[model samples]
Target: MHIHPLITDSESLKSLCDRLAQSDFVAVDTEFMRENSYWPELCLIQIGNREEAAAVDPKADGIDLTPLLDLMVDNEDVLKVFHAGGQDIEIVYNLTGKTPHPLFDTQIAAMALGLGEQVGYSNLVESLVGKTLDKGARFTDWARRPLDKRQIDYAIGDVTHLATLFPKMLERLRRTGRGDWLDEEMERLADPSNYENEADLAWKRVRISSRKADVLGRLKALAAWRENEAKAKNLPRGRIMKDETLADVASHPPAGQEGLARVRGLSPAWGGNDIGGRLMAALAAAKPLPADEMPGREERGPGLGKEGALVADLLKLLLKIRAREGNVAARLIAKSEELEMLAAGRREGLSILTGWRFDEFGRDALDLVEGRLAFAVKGGKLMMTRTEHSQ
Candidate 1:
């Protein structure tokens, strides 16, 4: 693979734009950081037209991104493709105040193609293209000057490889008659609201394994507080409080500074600071509920304890059979949540029964559960065989 550097200047950007305008499509990727800040720290932008793949230095002095942004808006005929595009699009929105026109997301396409949800880039490349990308520079700070040659190669490989991989995947998409499916998925990425962080619903991301009603209420308040704090300070969520810590606070519902001190992961400074005082006040103001009226904890037992462990194993085997048979990623076909719901005899929205996923992988899954399907150990490989009553 060859790497090309596009000088981050108006003249060069215009030249790059000229090349892209004549192309049918371009594969693009970005490298950025967001560990310490609320906004993505976009450091590098890589672009690949039909002929050459180039890396743009966004950190270079006096480098304006306007020309590139203009091309992104003007190239309506050319497809702008990326892998795992949401965060990358967020960076574009932040930098250009315009989303790229005619966008395609490989990750979304992968899911539509049955590659699975949140599939890593390396995994997709290895699985589909049969090549292993060098990941040595995975965590390098892109903002630093004098970027190492290997880093530049790694950065350029991102988009350059996609130039080849896109059409291969696209052909597969067309042959399977799922070409329009990708178009529908792209429409979701085009939505600006999906990229914007919804502050009101931010609490939904937190994980609360189990907690009392009052504790849950306090946790909600804490989430709201953290959300506001992170936004105001332009810092990461963990800089305020880590998710694990938040869950601990919710579970314990610390009433005082003393109580807050006892919770593990509670920052000592945070416990005694103004924020800590506010947390205490929120807890006090929250109406405590009677224990009996409080929300009951979810039941937990050994895998075999709740239902037969063998049943869960059968469901998993059935899921794999359905996934392979349909040539779709098993997770996207039916998540563990969906599987558990199905295994528990609750059969709402079983993709195997409802939509395209059902037609592709879901029906077989449900049949497997109904004992109309069986597995056999043949040639040292388990094979799913249809029983007469499977249908």
Candidate 2:
């Protein structure tokens, strides 16, 4: 495959994208820095097809990325391929307010193919294509300007390996008849809601130590306040306030803005700061969280009794056995929480009992939990067998 020189001009990038538009799929990768900011700083983007590849400089002066961006989000004929590309898609969404359509994530597909859960790019490449990648430039500061040949080579290497492996992987999926299994997952990766940062709902992401109505209300207000502040300042949410500190503040009310200095995570300067006053206002306005909206209720599952707990454990064992027998990732079949729900006799809304999941492992899970399936030994290996009670 021919690697084009670093793309820094619109015409060159446009031409590259136009040629790639005719291809069946495009393998893409991005290099960005997100350590100090809420938004990732996109520095380099490597895009490729089987015949060619190029590294586009996203930070190049006076260069517009609309052409490349259009290909990712607008073009429907070509599939956008990536390995563990959740962050990559997030970067694109940050820039364009849309994720790439007709998407495919090799890492997610690997789960169905039995490669493993959350498979890293290096491992996937090595496993599928048998090519070992150089790890030297893995930590390079992509934000640095005038990238060297070594850096460019390492960056471009990512898409090149992906471009090579996709066809072979697709073929294997076809042969095994598991290609359709990835359809729902791919659609999920393309959903725009996954990339949105709705501030009102941000508190859910923070770990909580209290379930009290007032505490939850304050936490909800504080988390929304922090999200707005982080977005305005272009800083990380943790830089504004850490999760533990947020939870602590919600649990313990200060007398006023002057009391902010006594807060463990806040600096003494906060005692008299405007932001400290903002926190006080948020706390003052907080109301008890409505019972209807409260989280951690028993109805959300996870309330298995001792006997139900034993059945959940047996269901997990059956999951392992089925995943091994089918050569698929256990998580792709059912989650631990879902098993507990099944064991607890709450089957109406469970995802494990629906669609492909039900066909894959949920059927046997239902049988096992309902006492129609049992574990047995055959030739010194643990295996699943139906009890006489099963039809």
Would you list the C-alpha lDDT of every candidate in the order shown? Answer: 0.74, 0.91
Q: For model 1, what is the C-alpha lDDT against the true structure?
A: 0.74
lDDT of 2 by residue, 1-391 (tens): 9999999998999999999999999999999999999999999999999999999998888898998999999999999999889999999999999999999989888899998977888998998899999989999998988899999999999999999988988998999999988898899888999999999889889888688999999999999999999999999999999999999999998988888898999998889988888888988998888897789655356778899899998999889888999999998888888888788787787777888888988888888877788999999988788998997
User: What is candidate 1's TM-score against the reference?
Assistant: 0.77
**lDDT score for candidate 2 against the true structure:** 0.91
Which portions of model 2 miss their true places by more than 4 Å?
Answer: 296-301
**What TM-score would you give candidate 2 relative to the actual structure?**
0.97
Pairs that collide in candidate 1 are 114-328, 114-329, 351-358, 352-362, 352-363
| Residue-wise C-alpha lDDT for candidate 1, range 1-391, written one tens digit per residue | 3445656676776677677778888888888989889888888888886588788988877877777777676568888988888788888877666688789888877876777767888888888888899999989988788888888889888887788888878988898888775664687787777766665455557777655567666666677777887888989989878888887776677657767766777767756888788767755665544465444332232234366455666777777776777666676556665666566665664555675767765676677778777788899988878898855
Pairs clashing within candidate 2: none
Candidate 1 minimal-lDDT segment of 10 residues:
296-305
